[model samples]
Target: MQLPMKTNRITITKITADDLEAYEKLISFPQIAEGAGFNLISNKQMLGELAKRQIANDNTFGIRVHDQLVGAILLYEQIGQCGFPDEANLEISYFLDPELWNQGLMTEALEKLVEVFKQTSEVRTFNAEVFVDNVSSKALLGQVGFQQVSTVIDPLVGRKKLIYKLEL
Candidate 1:
């Protein structure tokens, strides 16, 4: 399905095999990884694997600004029994190049994504996990109208992450 591009001057679309290179560049930035609570993307091979998964997954998108790849936004469905309160919800994740920070571009992109999700009818709620130390991300989620529901210490990342959810 082709997602309608919003006025953020970026096209939000499904991730394709051809986008591996761009995805790699965006995730390789240390600031981006740290803010998003993930390890640094070290190589193209890792990106290749990521691209392969994204291509097969229905809930991930490649975000492009002015036809140039900028970042990715993921929406993951909960499986089995999970700690989240809602079963019919999507977990939202995103990262952008550090150079593009504080430009209001990501805010615009996220707003457009929320609109698309609301129209798609796949889920009734959207959620995000932000590292507690990541003030910018917390503010961003708040700007998008997400309310903090809880904080969990991610055993894998060993950091306390704030979980925010929005009901559409």
Candidate 2:
């Protein structure tokens, strides 16, 4: 789906192979990966595979500023997996270029994602899990109307993750 440009001059669009180079660069930074609770990409081959997988899943969106990919916003639905909410719960996550830190670009992209999905998808809730140390992300989610639901150990991230929810 094509997301319209927002007043902040940002565009959030489905990622494709064309974005792999830019995406790889963004994720290769140790700070970016660590902040997002993912290990730093140590090899180009692994990064290539991950990029391809994201493009294939169609759940990842590229955040572009002036036509340059600077970040990615990704969503996961727990509906069919593990038989939990039957796909009614949507989980949101994102990574940004450290150079753009404190710029409000990420905040705009996230709010836009929530706005779009609430109008277009059957998903009942928008969810987010942030590591306990990521104060900025927690603040952003809260500012966008997501409430603190719980703090749980995330096996994948191996850290205490604070879950936030926004009911649409």
Global CA lDDT computed for model 2: 0.81
TM-score of each: 0.85, 0.88
Clashing pairs in 1: none
Over 108-156, each residue of candidate 1 has an lDDT whose tens digit, in order, gives 8889888776786767888899888888889999998999999999887
Give the clash total for candidate 2. 2
The lDDT values for all models are: 0.77, 0.81
Off by over 4 Å in 1: 36-47, 80-87
Candidate 2 C-alpha lDDT tens digits along 1-168: 346546466988777888878887888788877776447556779867877887677778888998889999887876655666566777887888989978899989988887877778787888888888988888888888999999999886578989899998
What's the distance in Å from true for residue 16, model 2? 1.2
